[model samples]
Target: MSHPDTLIAEDLLLLLMDDEKGRLSASSQAQPLLGGALLVQLALDGAVEVEETNSRWRPAKVEARQVAGTDPDPLLAGAWETVAQKPRSAQDLVSRLGKGVREQLQDRLVAKGMLERRQTRVLGLFPSTVWPAADRQHEQQVRQRLQDCLVAGAAPDARTAALVALLAAVDQAHKVVDRGALSTGEVKRRAKAISEGAWAAKAVRDAVAASQAAITAAVMASTAATVSAGS
Candidate 1:
């Protein structure tokens, strides 16, 4: 059976308090309560109220200074009084109190068990479609399956063919070296031979010269582009 839609009274209270203070400044538990967008909305709508804790003292207006040294509970009462007068948005609250103090207050609220969280299907802003909801267990299973597949193979099906082509190219390069089979002394002799027969080594000489010309041209082009862009 699906759970019924419920709003935590503490969360609504905190959001209302944050609205009044222009930021959150409660215990750690209150942080999560302030995070809920729905709770914020309810506080703005004036659907929630802060219950008076002490029966003996029923003052019309509770000053901030009065609850200065007391615990967060009493401060919450004062906050409710202030929020009840004027409803404000979360953004307005943050703007008034500053981000740092607002976040600290949220943390304090969350640390206490007074705040509660519930799941709700909120509408998507951009896509205009309901997001598929999955339970915690289903999400864990999906992650585990994806991890298992990755560990079994280095490359996925689509990339397997490309990997084979790369391996073949490496094998061909190795074959070329094997066919040349020149000893250390032979390699030195070949170098000397090339120097002696410079005209006969025209093919190798032209390749080296072409590479140097391309590099120089590329550097000149890049410099010209940089200068033009700057200007």
Candidate 2:
């Protein structure tokens, strides 16, 4: 049996995708963001543990270790085991957690008939692959839930609260809904209220914060490296 919360990757895929076109939104930061979400989901499942709790969240120094007794589902179990090779900080684990992570997730969604993997040779010279949604049912449901929590002022459940925290961490909540009707101040206020609520466990919330910060830092570093190389 799969819990709705266990579908974090699928939720993320839906969030990234454009329903009308069945294409992922253009974002250079997708890899790191997905990586952050994966690690947070693993933590939420108790498959991973963070070393720090009393201090403010710090991505560069927080160490994540595997829990000894929990048996996660097969998909997450693999990630838990891989990370268990050694305890690592959120920063160290971002790209590591992301490596080939998207492909693994796409394969899972395809197996469930949520998406179809397609390949094309662009202009007969460049190879490209796309994972387009096969059905919008699941994604639409998720979006409705998001609207409820983020816009309609409904209290969030655990999974929905966690999803908001992730979206706020990356500052991408606006992309999921039409925020134009709401003030930016209102959006931030709503997010903060939910984040501080019971639906968010202290540890899980910290993990999300640390992971998103690490992902952001990693993206900046990668971008700087690219510019330096080109220069």
Candidate 3:
């Protein structure tokens, strides 16, 4: 891809970031979405594929498998190699993929003077951090592209379409766009078409489904953790 820095994960995070507030909006979904984005990126690079598994005892699970040679991008290569080391279910793999990944990516962007770090707390007690935009132009472009594709019905190339699919599957797409731009019905219709469109690979679809379950589980698990902590 000509724009290697234009990672789908970064775009999603950028769009989620509240520049004026210096906090990522809907912080709960950030890591799960980032994890999903990484997997989707690996799939798009042809370095990984996901296998479906249906079980009554658990949430949706899928196996991540390597597809080809080493990816030239170190971040991609590192994650690719980690997946190669073991066969992991989507939730387990996402846990690994997302652990500290936000910090790593943010550090890279910060080093380039593109992002700024700020600290806050969840529920006014749990300390948390946010990466606000040090440079807003690039992220604005990313958000605009998403708006054009989902609202205006413009055709996006593969990578972008994959980002939309991953975000939508996790029920986070609406968080990034201007709702007034398109009716809820139009938004859903367009997002579904892009996500399930011909440009999306079978592996991407499976990964997204698996990640959706993983995201739900993560949200529930974190909420439980918070409750248990309070108790």
Candidate 4:
């Protein structure tokens, strides 16, 4: 049987998507965030492990646990299979597992009545499909959790902590968070603290840390390429 509740990646995607625009925010960086959420989810479930690194230069490796039965969620099955194939670095797995995941996620959300898929033409020539909110209640509840954790300084549950860490990894926390009275910097600081907090096991923390590093490198590389092209 498939997992019943929405996956953590689904929640993260909903949070990152702009309901009005029917598009994702930080589109380029969203894949890694979703991938990281999956890894973190597995870690929380004790289905994957991040090998400890003794040297600063070495990247921690991720390995999937050998379970007796099939994976519960069809969405996670591919990722689990990928990890089970071999022990790989988290950064590599993030990019590899991320490919083509967005389309799958969008389809699932659309079927669940959380989103609507609209087909249109960009510039009245190029065909495009956009996913707008069919229901805002779910997304709003997630935002409330984010607001409580980041702005109200409330203690986050495991899933919420993982979501916050992933958002912070992609530098999307400030963008998605509601800053009622706090400054952007403050929100970022709290997010960073949660990302580094002792809210999860070592393996889970390592997975999150690696994802953060990967996102940082990706952002920097993109910046460099843009600068080079401009020059």
Judged by lDDT, which candidate is best? Answer: 4
How do the residues 120-203 of candidate 4 rate in per-residue lDDT, one tens digit apiece? 899999999999999988888888998999999999987888889888887788888778889999999999999999998877
Model 4 / residue 204 / CA error / Å = 1.6
Error of 4 at 3 (Å): 4.5
Estimated TM-score per prediction?
0.18, 0.82, 0.80, 0.92
What tens digits encode model 1's per-residue C-alpha lDDT throughout 1-231?
Answer: 011122222223332332322332332323322332222222222323223234544422111122223233333343444445554433223122222333443344445432323233335334321112212232233223322322222222211211111112112111111223445344333323322233223332322222223223333555588789999
* Number of backbone collisions per candidate: 19, 0, 0, 0
Q: Return whichever of 1 and 3 wins on TM-score.
A: 3
Model 4 residue runs over 4 Å out of place are: 1-4, 67-71
How are the candidates ranked when ordered by lDDT, highest leading?
Answer: 4, 3, 2, 1
Q: For each candidate, what is the lDDT?
A: 0.29, 0.71, 0.72, 0.83
Q: Which tens-of-lDDT digit does each residue in 57-106 have in candidate 3?
A: 75444444545453366666667777778667777766677777777777
- The collision pairs in model 2 are none
Q: Where does the lowest 10-residue lDDT sum fall in candidate 1?
A: 167-176
Worst 10 residues of 3 by lDDT: 62-71
Selected candidate, larger lDDT, 1 vs 2 = 2
Model number with the top TM-score: 4
